[model samples]
Target: MSKIVILGAGHAGGSAAGFLKQYGFEGEIVLAGAEQIPPYQRPPLSKAWLKGETNENALQLRSSEFYAENNIDLRLGIAATAIDRTAKMVAFDDGTVEPYDYLVIATGSRARKLPLPGGDDDLLLELRTIPDAERLKQALGGGKRLAVIGGGYVGLEAAASARALGAEAVVIERMDRVLQRVASSTLSEFFTRRHTREGVIIRTGAEVVAVSGHSVTFADGEVLEAHAVLVGIGATANDELALQCGLECAEGIVVDLDARTSDTAIFAIGDVTRRPLPHYDVMHRLESVPNALEQAKRVACAITGRPAPQDEVPWFWSDQYDCKLQIAGLPFGASAQVVRGDSDTGSFAVFHLKDDRIVCVEAVNAAHSFMFGKQAIAKSSRVDAATLADESIPIKETLL
Candidate 1:
């Protein structure tokens, strides 16, 4: 029987392994990941896990018994060193060489390193792992001051959690607005307001120059003082192994619509792939649980001689303090945001339009709008902002 080797046991790697078996890929399937912990939900790590709202029991993605029953050769805590495309095998640090008929390059990304000079200590943390979250959680106890550098989702979430933990949290962002690059200014304003009302300090257009003993000095000569510092800027693709193998790589490993790489026998998914997305398309390296799992399932189907799954609008959600922010689709260069309710109430849906068509919808504390908007976006549903903002007409009817 031919062997199928999957690198990186996170959501994409592990999910593909299980689905390959579930879909009747009758061969050896081995899953490898750098982290020792099994594939668990990651979005919650920054949200629920940081707030003391989740336990270790709630983080398990699958029971150990399930792996045993499925006979998956699960290898954790071992990192893949390189891919020997010519040899058709994967080399690990442990001197183990696994030959494979099919190789899946799901080696996800790592937190983009902060280039600030000075004060590199073991105490400083990045919230990408269970161990990292534990350390952050412990540091979040009362009276701790956290200076979070970066105003993206992770940074904002960390700030919110730090505030909830009775700490003085300050967010330093290079962008002019929180989540400015990712969402509209309207949504950014709403989130910024939420963070401010929760007693979290935010500094937009601020850049960290250095870190020195509970203090982060900014380029503007402003110094931020804190007990602990958490950085959540973004992540860089873990493509050294792939790049060394001479695989086609851009900002990420380049993959086609089928998520297959330049080499048909090899494929990539998740945050590593430079998706073959067209103009006005935003499929490039989406860092969400849904994107990882969905692409993995598609790769599984491809490997199993089945049809690939259709690519839909990628969505993401975040839980901060007491509010849940759900995004329905990617809205690039969208012109209008029709709001039905007030941003203060946290009960509104922001409709994004492209060429006068509803391209995406963002909801806060509105689940029905999210569900309805998702279906509409999937169907390329055209609904005027006025009608979408009315809240009187059923959103589903807009799909027609």
Candidate 2:
């Protein structure tokens, strides 16, 4: 029987293993993961789970019995030490070697650590893993103050949760706006106002100069005292195993259009894979659950001699308090950003245009418009801001 081994049991790894069977591949499958528990969903790690509204069982992607029933082998908590392409084997940290005909590397990323001036790992924590959230939750214990280092998704979500827990949350972002890297400035402004109303101090263009114990010093000589600090700053790709195998590495392990690495026999997906998008013809490493699942399905289809699905426009969303923001497509060099509705009323979409082409759409508390915009962009259709602003035109027609 042909054997397939997959590394990292996150969304991509779990989906890849499940799809192999869905496609009627009569082969032995092994899933190796570094986490001690079964495969779990990551999207909630920062939001629901942090709010104490979720548990480990809710985070699991699959039940424990799912593996045994499907005849799939799951090796949890076993870190893949190296991949030996010559022998088609994977070396584990425990000195065990597993041979396979096909391999998939989905090792995601580690939370980028912030360099503080003091030796205070106790006060500073990152919200990447479950344990991290648990520790932060225990620290919250009702009323307190939390200083979030980055104003990105992770940071803002942390700030929102801190506020939900009845804590005074202050978010300090180096950029002039929150979520500036992913969402448009208009969307950022909407969220900034929302956070401000919730009693969370939103500071923009403020860089953290140093951190000593529970005190954070800003570049402008401003300092604040906090009970605990959550570093939601950024992430760094885990490429040690790939580098050991001599695979082409850039910011991540470089993969071609079909998710093939320098070695065609191997494949990389999710945040760790630096692959090129067909629509834009540019390399991108997106960190979203949708992208991970899509890449996994595509790689599985290719391996099983099935036709790959058409690539859809990439998108992501975040839930902070009651605000639901959704974004579609990548807006590179977007020359103009137009708002479709009243910004203060809590419903709007930021239309992005470049030389008259609708490159992307940022919707705040507007799921209908966001979904329609995603479909429009996926079909490569042209949409005008004037019609988009007018609810009478209807966004669904843009796809037609």
Please state every model's RMSD to the true fold in angstroms: 2.0, 1.9
Stretches of candidate 1 above 4 Å error? Answer: 119-121, 277-283, 396-400
Expressed as tens digits, the lDDT of each residue in 207-249 for candidate 2 is 7878854778987888899888777778888888899889999
- Residue pairs in candidate 1 whose N, alpha carbon or C atoms collide under 3 angstroms: 9-33
Candidate 2 lands at a TM-score of 0.95
Q: What TM-score against the true fold does each predicted structure earn?
A: 0.94, 0.95
Off by over 4 Å in 2: 119-123, 396-400
Superposition-based RMSD of candidate 1 using all C-alpha atoms, in angstroms: 2.0
Per-residue lDDT of 379 in model 2: 66
Best by lDDT: 2
Candidate 1, run of 10 with poorest lDDT: 276-285
| Deviation (Å) of 251 in candidate 1 | 1.0
> What's the residue-level lDDT of 341 in candidate 2?
74
Report the CA-based lDDT of candidate 2 relative to the real structure.
Answer: 0.83
